[model samples]
Structures are given as structure tokens and as C-alpha cells.
Target chain A: MHLSPMPSAIVATELSKTYDVKVRDPGIKGALAALARPRYRQVRAVDNVSFSIERGDAVAFLGPNGAGKTTTLKMLTGLLFPTAGKAQVAGYDPWSGGNPFRQRIAFVLGNKQQLLWDLPPEETFRLNRAIYGVSLADYTTRRAELVELLLLGDLIDKPVRQLSLGERMKCELAAALLHQPEVLFLDEPTLGLDLEAQQTIRTFLGEYRRRHGATILLTSHYMADVTALASRVLIINRGRLLYDGELSELVARIAPIKRIELVLSETVSRARLEEYGTVAHYAPPRATLEVPRETATAASTRLLTDLDVADLSIQDPPIEEVIRIAFGETEQDAEEDTVRTDVQRAPP
Target chain B: MTRFTRAMIVLRAFWQLNWLEELQYRGNFVASLLGTIFWLVMAMLTVSLFFRHTPQLGGWGYWDVVVLLGIFNALAGVVETVLRPGIGHLPTDVRSGALDLVLVRPVDAQFYVSFRRLDVWRLADVMLGLAVSGYAFVQTGRAISAWELLAFAVTFAVAIAVVYAIWVTLMSLAFWFVAVENMAALFDAVFEAARYPVSAYPGALRFLFVYLIPIAWTTTIPASALTGRLNPALATWAAAVGVAALGASRVLWRVALKRYTSAGG
Candidate 1:
């Protein structure tokens, strides 16, 4: 793989974004204070973050609320100009790339919609075809393919507001992908979707990436989406990149414990279950234990021999738990970090 | 193809969609027509009352003022048909961050936002206004020359430009004051002054309308062209003012767009 380096589809170097949020206290005093002499607070949304995504790679950005995931995505999509640092998507400066750059990339925000509320989804699809300058033949072909892949039948012809949330999101995806962009920046694409819809989208996205060899960077709260689609994960907290590596590597480093479950013919006490490892659950004939990865096999063998075990299984803990611990470790430390304003610039 | 032509193609698609959506609400056409007729009657009644009180207003006959009124209605028709529904949504879009969708497209954001919609029903107001102008011109018994007709065409286009420039400037203010949800109302209040001729106003107001706000150029100059009161020099000056207004508005739009932080960040 190192013999030929894959071209970078998206790159950011020391990207930073800060907003001058207006400050005001509570009640009439604050209103009067804002009128008398307005005050502003410098809030750093994304601080000196840098990462790059190679062509044909699916990457996931994970962060808590207000963690600069959206702010960074906006900068890369050319919707916001960075206060400091630089970024290039599809080999063009996102802020100044103009039509050439926009044509090569697509952005989909889950909560916000681009479709016309009063009109049918097909109308928006046609509008995008014109906006992206796609030919009639190509547009027809691509729209049909997306419709089939996403299982959107007559839903595209109905008004957007009339459709359910899941149906609307499916149409939203089709609308964004009409141009067949090489790079996709999806922000919470599966947010607020039902399990069935989420799974549909995840599967479609995986197939779409495989078919087009497109580069995708997504942010999702659902670990299932991350596990199903992304090959790499980037953990961001407090406007900084904490970890960027393979998902498996992150699991190995953050959570080095394996979970063991036992189905015994006889009921077991909590103390007996704890004798093997940390007792996760103890309910009659069924109990769960969290044991160190190095001793998980031995602990499972001992539990099987010592107790009247009927069935047993060992597996790594859920990715959500691992990520929760990752975020917890940095929650307090970020508060103590000093605010750096040396490179702050006026809003563009 | 050039970017402008491609943008036009996209705009055509949006307008087609708008037309289709408008077709779903056919009752609105009847309502809009009735509203236009009612306003026309009220406007003419107001002018009739003024005519009874005086032979001429500011040294012009009743029909001349009616011609200007007709021109005013025609321009208002353009606003309702195109500018109002299109650029009028800017403040709300900016506040709600809906403008993000427009910004991401390959087309020009200002151009797309300015002409993305058309109220087809209000287009009836345009034909009605023009019909009223023709009837009044016949009543004046003035045979229009080719030169005057040509000047009217230029000045009329200049009128639309001036009005559109006003809209762009007003809507651009949303980038700074995101909370001012209906900045278009301020424009409507100011545009009400363009109904009567600038000559009918006192010296201070005449100067304000002519030099400061420039609403006088919207209806007065174009009506003056049809009335044979416009000189070649004045028509050229009106054209120059139209271009300057457009240039200034475009510059303001660029500056203001940079300040769009996009809500829900």
C-alpha cells in the first residue's frame, strides 16, 4: 500500500475557528448594558485542528455537543471562512474555490434541509441538476440509480413536508448526491432517524462509496453507523483532535476489557460472580462479568469448570461505552486548558 | 458555457418549479387580481379628489399624474411578481440559516437569491398597469414618437434596476442585524413615496426623493419619458444612475455575505 500513496481528497492544516459571541447578562440590566456599550466574548469553536482524508476513504468525526465538529465541516464546505489556518477540499481552497470547487463536493446537514418545503423532492432534484450543470441524460440516469438504491419510489414526487422524517432524509440524500460529487461532507446524516431508516442509509452510503470510490467524512452519534460505514475514526473534544486512527485501534487503547457472559444451570450469587472478575450483571442462572483482555479466556474457562455453566460467550465491550470513557477522560482536563488568542483574527 | 448562462439555466429550473407550485393554489390568482383592482380604484379615486381641488398638481394635468401612477403600479407589479417573493425572503433565510443551501451551489448566490422565485399571478398587475397607462396616454391625445418610446423602454428597464438595487441593499442588512426578521417592510414603507411625482413634493422632500433615496427615478423618470418631458441628457443621466445603483448594491452584497456566520453552528 505504501508503494503508491493515495491522493488526498480533503486536507486541513492548523484549522482554527473562533466566534465573537455577544455577551449580555440577565434581565433589563443586560438589555440596558447591551444598549449602552455592547460586550463580546471570544469563543473558540475549533482550535488548531488538522487532519486529512485520502481518496475513497470513509472517516467518522465523533464529538460531544459544541465540540466543533460542525464548525470544522462548515469551513471545509466553504460555508464559513476560518479565522486562522487553511483547508483545501478537492484540491481547491474551499473559501475561494468558486464554482469549480463546489462542483466537486457535496454537503448534507441532517437537521437543516436544502429541499424546497412546498415542492416535490423531484423538483429539487431537477433544480440541483441544473445548478450542478448535469446533462439531461446523465441526470436521468443518476436520479434513477439513487432512487432505486435508496428505495425511494413515488416518495420523490410528493411534497417534502408531507413525507415522514425518514422519507424526507432519504430524499435529502438523493438531492445532495445528484451531482455525483467526489467528496461528501455529511454532518449527522443519520440524526433523528429511526433504526430502519438509519440502517437503510448506512447500507446505501456504504454501497455508494464502494460504487463511486467517493471520499466521505461524516459525524454521527450512533456508534452503529460508525461501525457499519467508517474505516477510520477521529475523536474530537473541546475544539481539539484527541484521537485519529482505526476504530479497532481506538477500542484496543481506550477499552482493554472483554465482557464474559455465563448461563449456569444453578443460580449464582453476586459475590461468586465477582470472584472471577468485575461483576457486570447477576440475575439467577445468567450473569455477566467484565474481565481484563489478557485473562478473559482463563476467566471464562474457570467459570465454565467451577460452575454448572450451560452456555458462555466472550466479546469486547460496546464501542459507545469505550467512547463515553474517552470523552469522560477529557471533560475535566479541557476546562483547565488555557485559551490561546495569539492567532485570533477578525471574522471574515 | 459561461457561468452566467449556467446560472440562468438553474434559475429557469427554479422558476419552473415555482410556477408548478403556484399552480396548485389557483384561488390565489383570483384573490390577487381582486386586490389589484381594489387598489387601482382607490388610487384613481385619490387622484380624482386632488384633480377636483386643483386644475394641475405641481404644474402637470390630472392625466400626467395618472400616467405616473400607472407607472408606479407597473413597477410595483414587478416587485410583487419577482423581487418581493425572491429577495424578500432574505432576512428570514439569513436568520434561519436557510441561505446555506443557496451558498453551497455552484451558481452565484446573490443572483440566485434575487431571482429564484416569481409570483405569476401578480404578473396580471403588470399588464393591467400598462393597459391603464395606454388608456391615459390616449386620453392625453399625445402621439408618441419612436424616440420617446425608445427612451421609455430604457428608462423603464432603469426603473426595475433601481428598485432591484434597493431590495438588494435592504436585504443585505440581514447579515448584520439577523434579528430584524422583516427588513423588507422598511423598503415597502420607503417605496410608498414613489407613487406620486417628485415635482408634487416640497423642495426638501423632492431633493430627498431625487438625490438621497432615489425613488423618484423609479417612476418619475420613466413616466416623464412617455410624457415627452424627458430630454436626451436626462435619460442618459437616469441610465448612469441605474448602473451606479446596481454596482453599489453588488458591492454591498459581497461585503455583507462575508458576515453570514450561518446559524445553528
Candidate 2:
């Protein structure tokens, strides 16, 4: 028997980051008070989050806004120091600012830019070439390949301010990869892109990963990004890791029910649909039901035979629902019940 | 072949990029040149205004002070060309968390941050300043000696280093006081004092420049070398101060890096 090789790229253990953010009220009195005596509050941006990435693996970090996904990426890339626990990228401590570690990792942020705004993108490329100490020969070859791959021929000569958002993002990706870093941390890489531009970037990233075998940790609010690019997903909420495994496993664990849609030839009573399973939606000649994954096939067969069904299909629940459940939205009633039970049991 | 050579290559790349970027804004070139000329003329008038009151300042004639002013302008040009565009952005970078990109690169962060950007039009100020210094030297009827020329070259390099160290020291404070958006303004306010000879200042300001703030090393020492007024015995002291300034700045940079929690953190 033959086995595939494992690529070990990033290892992190219990990483955390706490920030002392200065807080002051809004008023002249507050301003004078702050000047006389400053006040600070400590907030935990990343609370003991831990995960690992295998080399050549693409992992999606899924979280809602302010869920510490960006903070964790910052820590892994050595942009921020962890208050507790250790993180190592390509076998070097990221926070050390050692040359070897920096050479091995790349970080790209959608909101922030490294390109020289007034200069052409090509100039920035040359600057990166010299700064990263790439040999002239290698620089020429890699640049040609990137320009071709990213389709950045005419865009490269235009000043960055003149380029469209999609063009700038393409050039940004080229700039980040100029040194061929083994580990890549991308935060919201697809944010604010149209459908076609998003698909273009997604395809480019997939191909880049396949060719380079780079370890990639991506964070995005768009579910399509994860479904298309990542096989494994890590879910975090409120600065804590909730789940980490294959994407399929996460769906199975959080939303065990599969959605079945039936296009009936005739209208069906809402009561009849309720007997089959949970009626998520009901309309003319159409009805949707959520059934247990194990019972999905049986339910679909029964619906087809019992009703004059024209068409029918089954799909796993959407990732957004899975994330909402992960964030404790579904457990609200249960939590309220527990609180009520505790209150009744309490002694006076 | 060496790290310094590699750094020079990086600097050259930045210079080319900066030059092309500046060329697009040709109008700024005119504005910058006008600003330099206006300031140069103002400096000369200030010298004349002072000469009206006294025959000499700190035992140096009018032309000698003019030469020092020229050196001051040249150093100011260096600041605008390199330091302002480079380190002047540091506080904002720290606030916005953009400095994270600077830290992750394979290059030395300090070196890259200090020389990564240049404002090309300001190089004109450097040329005009040297020309003014030359004219002042001629007006003083000072014959050029090989020794004096060599001394000027070395001390002028020292002046640049001293200026760079001051910038590094000031900008590094962004790590601790991340909200201070105008750190460069603080430098500008203080550096304005260096436009005049240190000895011409009141006793308290002289002490402040010599010991406390160390702006004396920026222009006065270099001008002394050019005007044949440098005490041969003091050359060693000037060299030592340059070395010490660089060393202290390096240590401060390390400390500041330690203090950086990054933007979000």
C-alpha cells in the first residue's frame, strides 16, 4: 500500500492577544480629565485560540464580525504578539522578527495595501525584488509568470491609483507572492469584489496553491469562498474556537438535518407537510422541508409518491445557518429554559 | 557580494520608483523649488539682519554663518527627501495597523522603513544648498585645503547620520504613544533651532542643543569643518558623538519594537 505525504506548515498552541485600549468619554470635561489622568481598558482580541495547518492545505477560518479571525491571523504572521501560548510558522517563532521566519510567510489584507500608490505596480514589483533579495534572473522569470497568470500586462504599468479594485488586488497578490513564501495568511481576500472578480481571484488562488503547495489560512465572511477554496474549516465566535475539522464534519455536527424541496404538481395542505417534517417554507406548487440526514431519502420518496410531485431535490443546509447555530443562536430557548429551571430551584 | 550592497540595491530600487512617481507631479517640483529658494533667501536675510546688530556671532563673520545656514538647508533637504516620507508615516501606520506589513518582510524592518520611500523633487534643495555653501565659502575668501575638504566630507556624512538618528529616535516613540499623529511636527519644531550656529544661541539654548537635545551636532559641527574653524582636537569628539548617536538609536529601535503591540493588538 502507498500513502500520501503530509505537509506540516504551521503549528499554533493556545495563542491569545490582549490590548490596552484607551477609553474616554466625549466632552470637554472628559478631555481635560483624560489629559490630567489617562484611563485604559484591556480587551482580549484573541482568547486562547489554537489550531494548526498542514502544508499544501487550504483552511477557511469562519467567524462573524469581531470574532477574532483577523487578530489570530495577525498573531500567526507575527504582526501582533500573543499574550499567552506559542505559535510557530515554518518552524520559526513568528514574533521573534528573525529573518528566516519572515522569509517563509506572506500576509495579505484586503483593507490595507503595500503597493506604492503613486507609482506603477511594476515599480513596486521591482522594489520587492530588491528588498527580498531575489536574484535578477529569478525575479524576471517569476514576474513574467505572475503577470501572465494574473493577466496583469497593461495594468502593471498604470499607477496603482488608476487601476480598478480587481486589478489592484491582482497586483497585490503578485507582490505578496514575489518571494514565494511557504505560508500565506489572507484576511477577507474576496471582500467587496463582484461575482466575476471574486471567481477570478478564487481560481487564481486555487491554482497558486496547487502549484506551490503553500499552506494557506483564509478568513472570509462569504460562504462561497470557503465552499469553493477550503476543504477544512475552523469556526470561531467571540474570540474562541468552536469547531475545527473537515467542512463536511462541521455541517454534520451543527446542522444534522438536510433540506428537501418538493415542486408539487398540485397544492399541498400545510398540515400534511408538517406531518412529514419541519415545514421551512410553503407556497403554491412548492414546499420545503428539513428532515434528519438519515431520514432524508425516505422522506423524499414518501413525498414523491404521496403527493403529485413534479420535481424534488435535497441539499445539505447552508453554511450560514451552520455558523448561526455555532454562535449559540439556536440554543437561546434552551438557555432560557435552563435559567428558568435554576431560578425555580433556588432557595429563598 | 555583501549585505550593504544588497541594501544599496534596495535603496536604488526605491529611488527609481520615487523618481517616476514624482515625475507625474511636475507642478510639485516648481512648488518645492520655489519653497527652497524662498527659505534660502529668508535665511540669508536673517543672517544680514543679525550682522546689522553685531560684527560677528560666536566669533564667526557674516559669511561663515551663511555657510552654516546653507549646510542647514542641505540637511533639511535630506530630511524632506528621505525621513519625512519614510518615518513620518510611522505614527499613522502604527495607528492603522499598517506597520504589520512592514514587519513581515524578509528585509530588515528598520532599514526598510527608514529608506523605503523618497520624495525626489526635494533633491533639488540638496543641490541648491551645496551651491549656496560654495558661494558663502568664496565670499569668505577661504582657500580650499585638501585636509579641510576631507574633514568637511567626513563631518557632512556625520551630519546626515546624526539627522537620521534623530528621526529614528523620534519616530520610534510611535510604538508607545500610538495616538501621537504629529511626531514629525515635533522634530520640525526642534530642528528649526539648528538653522543657526549653536554658539550664537543664548547660554541656556546652547546647553540644550549641546547636551540635552543634541541638535548642535546636526549643522554646527559640519559647518565648522567647512569653514576651517573646526578644532583638530574636537574632530575625535564629533566622530564619537556620531557613533554614539547611531548606537543609541539602534538600541531605541529594539526597545520600541518590543513595545509594539501592533494596531489591533
Which candidate leads the pack in DockQ? 1
Question: Can you write out model 1's per-residue Cα lDDT over A249-337, one digit (the tens) per residue?
Answer: 87667667888988889878888788899987788687888899899999988988898999999975654456556556643455455
Looking at model 1, the pairs that clash are: none
User: Over the stretch B59-178, how does candidate 2's per-residue lDDT look in tens digits?
Assistant: 889999989899999999999999898987788888998888888887778888888778888999999998999999999998988888887888888888888998898888888887
Candidate 2 RMSD computed on C-alpha atoms after optimal superposition onto the true structure = 6.5
**For model 2 chain B, where is the 10-residue window of minimal lDDT?**
B176-185
Checking candidate 2 for backbone clashes, the offending pairs are A7-A55
Per-candidate local distance difference test: 0.87, 0.84
Candidate 2 is scored at a TM of 0.85
Where is model 2 chain A poorest over a 10-residue stretch in terms of lDDT? Answer: A339-348
